[model samples]
Target: MYCKHCRQVMDNDFCPDCRKATRMPEADDICFLAERGHPWSDILCDVLKQEGIPFLRQSNLGHGLMSMIGQGLELESIYVNWKDWERAVDVAAGLFSEDVEILWDEEDELQE
Candidate 1:
């Protein structure tokens, strides 16, 4: 989500400007589905939403007392409701396919 004050992309639910949670709808459930990077995670979430599947994004923290005391490793991940898992995956795959096709068309033009 974009910050209201600075208009920059927010790192988490809380907007840096107002120090309040962004007024976006929360997902019904959460499941760690995919983890490529920030960009891919964002894209996947968007695809799921476009397909009417609800989801939430999350990340692992390291170099902290909580990390050392609780979890041993840090791993970024994305999540969707169990009910929406299959449909979300399908939608993400379709989005990827469309992106690939667009890239192919651009490449074909470059080749010509």
Candidate 2:
């Protein structure tokens, strides 16, 4: 177990040295759900927030010129706590699916 903020080994929920909260170590029983580059990822995240579920979002986006050229990198991964994984999965499936329909399309390319 380690504290993400302090990079120190953790024995409890709070780091002893830094006294900061540390996420529970991942165990065999721990579960997670991930969404990759899906436009609906934002909506799903909002739903999870509304439902009071803890989650982590890992988005991979390019910076500067590369990003502007490619509309940024395309990985937006959402991970949820094991207990909430099922709920998140249901929301992703029942409400939103892999093939999410484009709600609206607007071009916002920088013009300079």
* Predicted structure with the largest TM-score when compared to the true one: 2
Stretches of candidate 2 off by over 4 Å are 1-31, 70-73, 98-112
Residue-level lDDT for 64 in candidate 2? 62
lDDT (CA) per prediction? 0.56, 0.61
Candidate 1 lDDT by residue in tens digits, 16-101: 66786654333443444566454566566655665677666656664575456654343456666656766766776676666463
Tens digit of per-residue lDDT, candidate 2, span 1-112? 5465543333588888778887765432233356556556776676677678777876666456446766434666776665666677787676555675644323312322
Best by lDDT: 2
- Residue pairs clashing, model 2: none
Per-candidate total of colliding backbone pairs = 0, 0
Model 1 alpha-carbon drift over 4 Å, by segment: 1-29, 61-75, 96-112
